[model samples]
Target: MAERSTADLALTLTRASRTPLPVQVADGIRALIMSGALAPGDALPSTRFLAQRLSVSRGTIVAAFDQLISEGALLASQGRPTTVHPSLPAHLLQQVSAAAPDPTAASTRRPASPGASTAAAPGRPDPVPAPAPASAPAVDLRPGLPRTTRIGDAAWRSAWRRAAAAPEAETGGLTGLPDLRAGIAEHLRLMRGLPTDPAALLVTAGSRDGLELILHALAATRGTLSIGVETPGYPGLRRVPQVLGHRIVPLGVDGNGLRVDALPTGAAAPDAVIVTPSHQYPLGGSLSLDRRLALLEWARNEDALIIEDDFNSELRYTGAPLPPLSAIDPHGRTVLLGTFSRLLSPDLAVGFVRPTGAALLAELRDVREVLGVRVSATTQHAVAHLLADGTVRRHTRTERLRLGRRREALLAAMLDVPGVRVLPMHGGSDAVIRFDTAGSHRGRAGADPEARAVAACADAGITVGRLSAAWGAESQAAPVDPSPAAAVGGVGGAGIVLGLARPADGAFSAMLPRLASALATVHHTR
Candidate 1:
């Protein structure tokens, strides 16, 4: 087989189409392989090269490549060019060639349904099993998902019954139901040790919506602000700002969470900074006391707003939980974002934004009046009932114990996996594992052990989060730096972010050995 140039692939991508660019790329490559245009041993263009040729983000190309690799349609090893799987049966290639549809009649042909399968002609091997149906993973280890099944059915029913019995309000009002606000204020005071006025908190759809509300309010006063976000931070929160026309300045994090010293000054200073002080996402490092103080001081000096996402703070398994930045902000520069998504259920679509300063509170209120209330009166009342009756609190305590056991199990399972280190995570619903990509464990020039580990887990009916994905698209185009400071500016090290909230206790325990085995395989292969 001749070595193919980057242009030889000639992938056609339609931006206007509903399908994603990565899927289009993967489908094109798969078609080429099936048609024998790309032979069994034919090498493919590098992701970067192909991304450049296609005028798409390198991350897009990487996703396509990863999907192909996972489907066994391509072969990839550390430091070598990706190639068509050398073991693809010759008969399959011949069969596809013989059955090739005419380009002239392509538009006239009906597309096959996603689940439709072609029966094998004569005695040909079944078409590679169609890459496993896109069903829910038997063991889902993705982060941000909480175990909602643990909530007592009695408590759940009682909360809703109370909500249903309450006199209906014409509107949830601009800031949300007064009762819900009061309930949230009390909940925060008791649980998070942050005393807040119910009037100061504005109801939002969730944390992301809370963030959007903050940005909208802030942007109303200040035009497109430069917002500092932790590198390798939660993409869900990061995307909210980006989509709202704000510029994102990537900040680095370490063992103690967001690096205070790295905060840019002068012209580079951000107008606002978002931090997960209680428990950082993916990395699971809480901001240290010193760093928290420093961050508050920096915010005061720079006159920058601090957005604290206090999601999953109550789920900490070990040690006393730290006070939220909003609780300690003496200058009233912080706005706290909270959500029922992690503690209760995401289906509730309920959360709140509490600003420390009276001025900011007024600003958020004014913005809310203009935007109108999003949460329904019924939902707000339901959540208020939950909080008022201590159901939420008791449920939270139970979930903490349940999730703690899961976290401990995850730790115990990975303890003996060679070349893999599960980073210490005190709270939060997820844990991170860094791969030993250097020294003797360094596989090949370009091998990504973290990616391979994730692929292996996927092959075993387990789905896990990729650490590299947290760094955004640019990181995906190339190899991760794997340095402690690699994520200083959104670039990150190689690892997997394992969510501990999905599988049941027994199922999770059963999945751990499989997960550990996958890690071991990646290590040995490297």
Candidate 2:
């Protein structure tokens, strides 16, 4: 056979179609084989070369090849490029060619009458009708969720297979599987630039579980400690300390994240401060260098600890990511909370807590021993494999590209809408759309434009985040212009938060127009 480049195989991809890329590629190849464009025994291009030529992930090409191989259309060996099955019967190819319908002719065909017979001709097998396309699921614009369809790729299955085959460990232990802990440590060092000892890392179900464990450990030793949380912050994190009977201090936040200068001093200082410095929740602001330094200084002077929720910092679309708070802390007073919920899938329920201080680490270990391990041994093993084989990093890169495009689509859709502004951010899974109500009667009456926006989105079958939910009870109660022109805590004005991670690429694009229309309606209303 003559040598042929992958360019010989002409494949067109429809980016706007709801069909997944891998399936599209596979179907394209199958059609080529059935049509005799690729003859039996013909060699195909390497997956790496094909992936680059097609501008898709390598895993996508691998999946397409795997699908074809399973159906006896392609053959692959350990070290050779894939090829069309040499032993494929010529009669089978002819049959497939004869059965394939002409799309153009089908498009122009008239519908049969109600009384028309639908049976195949005598001595012919009846053709099976194609299944109807499934309706798209509801669009969820609430933050923190990610596109999970990509997680079920070959790497994911392979990870689980390895885990199932491995000998079951005697125990997951107080801190989780040793191999998983080591994997997490290396991950943090490479991704977040935070050097961590495997011993200092404790695996938890997620950020919430890690926070609960920390609170319990601290309460057991120090009694009811005051936990400082960012106002208009993650309600889930705030609720953890509140439910544990600890005092919740509402800290002020600006565009640069938490206001370190405004931190209470003397008798009112908090015992620990929980913050999302990488990308502030709801607002999507990075903590300034000056504030980071001041926060560390405040923690030292007050003898407090910093619980850093390094949330969604890795999904940044533009610019370099700032170093995590734990990476720069000088006093060893920071406890870093990391999770795969946003990077991978929330269903994985895997996260890690790493403290810089020796005493704090020891205390957390002791507390975990009493509480026992919350994650299953199999889960830990699977996650450890993902981390070890670079699957997590590759997946993160793919997701970042996907989310960046979604963010751009959102910004473009909302750009022309009157009285709406999309906040600027380096990276995050969600965007804040501020509704401008300046000089309007609703603005003067404290009409809560954010609430109205949320209602409008809900009515359109889209669930979105409300900025008001981020505020503490007291902040929500304070009298002020609910719809101000200036950004509040850097988030600016009343707006709805849209999660960019939940929808499929095609569904997300389709959703943009509806979202814009809903927000426009809310803006023009009295």
Candidate 3:
């Protein structure tokens, strides 16, 4: 039981492997525990010290620990030092022995034919369609994406000009050129009704990066995390916590938003929660004031941190932009993430996360410094100008009206189509359509993944997404149910996202009728 930091302890855990750093770290630790190189009751290293020694993000270290915990290989105590759980070895043995043989596995060595393994018939809806070629897009009706085709020549040139002219940011001040943060702060203040202090703003490469940064800060001070998420939420939201080793508790959502009453009570609930209150991702339901108050109460009681990722606040076709959850967070628990990707363009990749306050921001800033820089000051500056000149803001407003019209067009077009059922979202870019026959896109083998099923739709030049990954599974331990085709309306859907903002305007034209026809086909047969 040495007093050394986690980094020093990780020295004993290093192995040369092609696996991800997080996985390798987990494997190394797994080997030590399995071999009894580290004894029960022995203390594990601190995450920071280990990350410092291994030269990886604390997030990466957290991911390692998350995996071990998931496999019943490690246990962590809150606020106290991490230790080797007494029964870890015995449990690890049980886990190792109980693993099912994957016939699809590259190294399928089991005696039984892998195909013979019937996964106790998936009780969930029949699995959905196959994946569309990432590059193949005729009329992209895929949802959750934004139109970025309006970055005018004048604004584009000006942004580049500012970026070209701005000097490297000083080593001491918060990221980006001086004017960029100022511009963004002012814009958020005026447009979003957010009183953002320039000093508190830290620009990031993207909203995803911003999430990573906030989660990194939260993980360092806690152990055994449970972060809350919506039931039918963005799959991408779960990745950050899963990677950080936090258990995601599925919070039910209705007309309002995340049901605060469903949050785990006592000391067992999550230390943080990520939400899209402005407009719930995928579901598109905005959190009402009552729910917001309830969420704030839960956060106060649970002492939880709220991560507000408000990407599409500006694109609301209906109603005023509600006050961000972060703005009303009295305890400074909310960390707001604002991204230019959807508002301006996906390629902009500029995002700013306002931390709880200066103190937390400083701690996170140090963490970023330790990771050898996670963002670019240059792009940050360019985005700052876009906000200052009203180019990004004006374009976002204009696009909101445009997307609003398109939403109506797509909705109206699909009104008469058969078998295609879309749940209406109050305001969002994509639709979620439930298809009758499970399409071939679901890579899940147990379900009927016959190519003929997918070809039936493909022949009509329509594409769709399999719902397994998009929707929640029974548990984090379980993959999404592989049944009844759920042709996702986002990214890859039969109804194409129809982004008039892309370089490819002709793509949507081809997709519209096919979507209408597919709907008609599904309805007529029904």
Candidate 4:
């Protein structure tokens, strides 16, 4: 095969597509390979050269190349140009001409730039367009997402380099890398005041992955267990158990977190229950100490396990951090599910599980190994380096301060809005606003005020989460059995969850007044 210039690649990209630039590039190359535009052993352009030609960052090109290499569609050897797999079948070569981009595409389509639509540049090929950027939200208040730009670029690059240098054969055994586990243990001891044995921690893809592992380990002995999750709780957590063919029991929450008194007893009692203790999702309330002890006792008495999701506990801006259920449990009935998705970037896809016992932990490890459920080796190492070098701690500190400021801005914006009750957020990046219709003045026909409120916010280019949507599907699908002692104590209502960690400091200032007006409109319409 002859070496072709970058311009001769004939790649067409649309900026308006939902697909990311890197994915688009990768898919384009893959299609070419499958259709045999690039033959067996044909070398591809260097990352730097391709990046320049595509007008994208080198990192984007690197990511695409890495994905292809992983799939065996391309071969990457040290100190040599990347080439197509030598074993590619001969029949695919026939489709090359049909798969190639139309040569007249440039002439037919208008250019994006003004005044360039009709100005013909003779024989000049159309420039490859980057993916269209989404319109910016005036204020982004969706919870569980962090502002990853706060992380230092230098530190991030250094961590990746350290990860790349890791031994390819070091699969981290069953749990994960030894250094990573040790780093996680030390982090728990110092930051969370929970001393953990390194061997007790099992690295997972995320908190959900950790939950799945535990369920897999328990399913053989427990046999299709019933699980209890909070009402108006995390939809993600609620879906997992049901997806695994287990029944869901809806437990409700008040201002002080989950109602432990409502937990079922006897044969109907759940085998396991998941709780977000330090900071409850959507509601932004902590579990009271007395209730915490009571809940732990229930777990012990019922012979049930508690899956404590200590999400956003480290971002506390007021008072002291409450001890997690795992930290206080004496009976080892609590398994802690912690993730970097809220604290760091969700892109990392890194989390860990602190199982109830060494035996159970071993079982979980065995299950993970059998199922081949391990986080990326590179990601594990990178996160380990960040944790070991105190980079994560430093980043958390910076992010906390940033989130605190945004919280204040959010409060300031909602001060004048009537009939909307704002809950106090001691920790976490989100706050709940309950909509009341007592003295609403501006009326709308045949529309729910809460729905109108959310729609208005969206129309104003301000994104906010709906609290009512988080209710488990089981609660909605099943009829209300009021006779049961374990029936949910609370009912779903209209409320909004505003995430404080999303907006940049500069963008926040301009968004506040607009948000206030939107809230006011909702109040008036109600």
The residue pairs in collision within model 4 are 15-132
Q: Give per-residue CA lDDT, model 1, range 30-69, as digits (tens).
A: 7666644565665677887667657789999899999988
Per-residue lDDT over 1-526 for candidate 2, one digit per residue giving the tens place of the 0 to 100 score: 5432221344557778899989998987787676555667767778886687577899998999998898888888778678888777565477444422222221111122121111111111112222322443467777766775866579999999988877875346888888899888767655554446788799999999999887776666557777788876777787778766677777877666777877888867777889998788878877777788889889878777789998887776564345677766656777888888767878888999988666677778888888888888888899999988878866776777787787788889988999898887668888888776765566455366776677677667688877766776534322232233224633224667778887877878877887898889877776
Candidates ranked by lDDT:
1, 2, 4, 3
lDDT tens digits, residue span 1-526, model 3 = 4331121131222345567889887876675555333545556667876676466789988999888777767778788777666566555644331111221222101121111111111112322444544555534333455554558888888898877676664422446456777877766654554556677787777788888777676655554456776655667666667766656766655435555666677755566777888777564677777788788788767667778888577666664456677655666667788877776667777777887555567767876776544456666667777876678666765676666666676677767775555555555565555544434334545233222323444545444443343445523332222323222222222321222333243566556666566445543332
lDDT-superior candidate, 1 or 4: 1
Worst 10 residues of 3 by lDDT: 108-117
Residue 385 in model 4: shift from native, Å? 0.6
Candidate 4 whole-model C-alpha lDDT, 0 to 1: 0.70
List where candidate 4 sits over 4 angstroms from the true fold. Answer: 1-137, 439-446, 476-490
lDDT per model vs. reference: 0.73, 0.72, 0.58, 0.70
C-alpha RMSD of each candidate structure in angstroms: 28.0, 21.9, 22.3, 24.6
